[model samples]
Target: MKQYSFNFSFEVLEEFKKLLPVNRSKKILKKYLLNEYVLSESLNDLQEIISETVIQPYWMTEAEIIKLDRLIKQAKTKGYSINRSAIMRDVMNNLVDRYRNKPIQKSKQHRQTFKVPKGIKERLSLLIEDGELTYELSSFIMDGYVPSNDFPSMRNKDQEDLNFKTDIEVFDKMDEISSEYGFKKGGRAKIFRDALNQFEAWLESDPPKKAALKQELKYILTEYKNVENISIIKEEINKYLKE
Candidate 1:
């Protein structure tokens, strides 16, 4: 986090040589000037190198070297040790080998395909039943809309005079109720289609949504059965009246 500035010279190099091994002194000195490590001793070494060396160095100027020294000191205080070039080379090679051996991830662009489940089939069947139930409820309401000759007691009277407005209202209310139940078209047809698509994905990937889709299927089936029973009862009544 701390910034630094410095001037490089032979006197700085002498100071750096005191702390670094003789074999590594020049290499470490070059790295120090490169801002590889910020050490107090390295800064002193830079001063020594700059003062003793008569020929001007071309890699970095005195001002740049001074900046490098400050950075080295800051990095040292933060407990960061500089890695030697040889060490970095080995580490990079190991990383490359590990990456080469690891498995590649599948592309999201690939098309996903899966088989339909039996539960989804059952859901489709339930959707059909629900559709029939909605139609039956609609018929009940429609019957109230017009008078029927089957009602022998009221045969001579106008069916409209029977005042079945409440029956019509009840049928309209049923539609509102079904709409709130997440049934598009007053039935589970849309839900069935969606669940089938999700189920197919679950079969392919066995993702977490699979359990949720299964639970949803159970709910739809139960609701469908209830509506289907009501529809059947209504059908029976309508049939008897026709006979």
Candidate 2:
């Protein structure tokens, strides 16, 4: 038996943890390494990789190692030489694409009718009459029109800007997490980590603590929008608990 290791970020690692809960890492890697098309694509991606900083061990059987060596030699002969890390990186990346949490489709923007302050409504009407604005008054306002320097100031010292109530839609917080944490596309890993953390806590905590964690998990299930396959992961968690 031979063992191989590859460095990957926390998110990449977590994605694999959830995606292959029951399958061995070697089995997955062997499948990718033996595939000519997948191996070539993974090697091609190495040219632009900045490299991940976390190293994790993966075991490989003797026969799997032999096949990987052959593939490496073949790729080198074709002038597509790549290191083990590069190949593993591409393998993990492909797995991420195949198993990453997909966004749940939500409704598009819908028009909501609301009354504007008399002063603001009058101001909008005047703008329409001046031929400076083209859209209907409600549409223009709802579209979040910003007053330009050429236009008169909509705000005065005594009057505040009018607030309009708009329909609240199911919004995915993963986008914000990605931006805030400097993750380009791995924010969905947070959901998996959080859910697992809550389950772990529930397992060890006192009654009061368990009660809090229970509520926290429920809140997480409700608050984190657009995560698919959550229930499948939950089933895996349940299986672990039963064991």
Candidate 3:
């Protein structure tokens, strides 16, 4: 069996300690692997780590590598560079996927105790925190968002048109819409925001006619499966109706 080792920063390992289940299982590993942005960020962090680093090691037989070569090919076609780190990451991801087909173990053998690095909170409390941030982080992971490299001085120009009070506020709106539509719960906010990006103009237009607003909203709801494009729309329409 060939052993593969992936390096992680102390900080990134802390993040995994928070995000991963206390009783580590291949199932949870598969979930994170499917999150493109999380995987991307993980790989990026490994490259950026200049201080203390940790090694996460996994072993694989030659047959296992050959069996999962298809996934590596698919990733390459999607523009992911073929590198040692990428190959090892994909192999680990593929094993988790393959494990899904095996019979579930009744003896809890699948769940192993995860050793969190120093400076992290206790496992029990971390799980509680994970409950709150999972949805938010999952939103980023599924969306494949890579952070912009623009300097802090240029941020105002990029966000001058943003209407949301905060990024969390945007995710909160997505959570609500997801519940109504029974769709990508906790993820639709970004998608919808980008879809109806004209909300600023729509809100400040002359007269702000309630009837016209409803007509436009009705169209959005139809296309997006009964979703409210954004919370501000409903609030503004209600205020306009009263006037």
Q: Against the true structure, whose lDDT is highest?
A: 2
Expressed as tens digits, the lDDT of each residue in 1-243 for candidate 3 is 544445434454444444433224333553444443123433333234233433443344455455445545655666554444454444344444454456234222121122222222233223223333332233332332222222122223323222222234334444565555555532354444332322222222321233334445655555555444657666766899999
Best of the candidates, TM-score: 2
Q: What number of backbone clashes does candidate 1 have, counting pairs of residues 3 or more apart or in separate chains?
A: 29
lDDT of each: 0.34, 0.44, 0.39
Q: In angstroms, how far off is 172's CA in candidate 2? A: 38
lDDT digits (tens) for residues 1-243 of candidate 2: 433545555477666655642213334556766663245544466655442344444445666567757767777877887666666666777776766665223234333232222354344433233222221122222222222212122234243233322112211332343356565544433332332233223223322223334545665655453564778767866998999
The TM-scores, one per candidate, come to 0.14, 0.36, 0.25
Which residue runs does candidate 2 get wrong by more than 4 Å? Answer: 22-26, 35-37, 41-43, 101-243
Candidate 3 minimal-lDDT segment of 10 residues: 107-116
